[model samples]
Target: MAVTYLMLARLPEGGLGAFDAYESAVLPLLAEYGGRLERRLRTLDDRVEAHLISFPNSEDLAAYRADPRRSAAAPLLESSGAAVELLAVRDI
Candidate 1:
């Protein structure tokens, strides 16, 4: 069973920079966990700022979530006040 994880993020004010930094450091770590950057940076609207990322499976997604690198990046994301919405879907 292959699962997909979709992450939707709403960056806080002055958070894009922090998000960028986090992404730079965490992206590779994600790959190490069997996750691929299906969508790195995506712009939702000109006025609103948000991003969507997809992972290959739940295992990879979980690995990314539990990774120490991700832990390190947590503060930056928190400081940026980024809102994260996660959805996990198993392939039918």
Candidate 2:
């Protein structure tokens, strides 16, 4: 079954630049894994960032997570100290 993910991140202190870099690096990788972004949003008040993505299946999601480029960009998340919450769902 197809899967959907709601990725919520707590932006880092100097969040914009790092977040921007993270976005640039990761977004395209999703497509390679048979996934696409459905919606992306961020709130000014809490600076909570969210992205809604759909994938063909769990395997696609796993591959996306394992992508080398994505793994390299992983450091941006670490240095920025962003908290992340990933929620996965699917149509009933």
Best model number under TM-score: 2
Candidate 2 — which pairs collide?
Answer: none
What are the clashing pairs of model 1?
none
Report the alpha-carbon TM-score of model 1 versus the true structure: 0.74
Q: Score each candidate by Cα lDDT.
A: 0.66, 0.85
**Runs of candidate 2 exceeding 4 Å displacement:** 90-92
TM-score of each: 0.74, 0.89
Evaluated against the true structure, the overall lDDT of model 1 is 0.66
lDDT string, candidate 1, 12-87, tens digits: 5677777777767777786676665565455754123433345565666777788887897788877776787777
- Per lDDT, the best of the predicted structures is 2
Candidate 1, run of 10 with poorest lDDT: 45-54
